[model samples]
Target: MAVAYVYGAESRDISAPYSIWKVVGSLLFIIAFIPLTLWLVKKFQLAQMKLSQSEIKVVSVQSLGTKEKLMLVEVEGERMLLGVTSQSINHLKSFSSNARTFATMMDEASSPETPSSTEEKKL
Candidate 1:
């Protein structure tokens, strides 16, 4: 809008035509927005994932990079990968266009934790 306004003012034309470069620029802008929007969307999804669940049974915890940890959990027969850190948790998973159930059995197997008892331990 700002750029369009500037062009309109310079040309003294209320209907400043949209050129190919302008279209290309718009296309490039939209293309650039793809990754950024995806990042934001992922951030929101992770936030919602973290907040929606009552609890996440730590399926498997492993080192991500150095200080980060990865977690897996099961719910309604679906698997989710969670990124744990000192500050917050981030959910990382393959992008799905529509609603789908991801079969992540291997991930579950590789990341299983030793099941412990809920009852008091007889230590």
Candidate 2:
């Protein structure tokens, strides 16, 4: 709008002609936004799909390199370690139901000790 105003002032034309380039650029952005928005929405949907009740979930991920990773995934209460690379994904190991997860260990470590429990143990 500023650029158009300056052009109009310089030309001394009351009805300043709109720049074709600006109109074309604006139209291009409008057209491009739809696909860009759709792509972003699709990517977000795929990311959110990783977790759901009664479905497979990625518990944790360890990146080895740009395209290599070790992922711990849970499916139907069974946890499995998978080695992922650019070529393919390989199953490393399977964990049983009684296995202690990293989350459980972290929770135990971070939890505060009760004063009553400590006094009882001392007694």
In model 1, which regions exceed 4 Å deviation? 1-18, 61-123
User: What's model 2's lDDT at 26?
Assistant: 96
Clashes of 1: 0
Clashing pairs in 1: none
lDDT tens string, model 1, 2-103? 999898788755334557568888999999999999999999998987888654345556787777888766555455778889899887863332434345
Report clashes for each candidate as comma-separated counts: 0, 0
Please name the candidate that would achieve the greatest lDDT relative to the true structure.
2
What tens digits encode model 2's per-residue C-alpha lDDT throughout 46-70? Answer: 8777554447778899999999999
Q: Please list the C-alpha lDDT of all candidates, in the order they appear.
A: 0.69, 0.86
Worst 10 residues of 1 by lDDT: 94-103
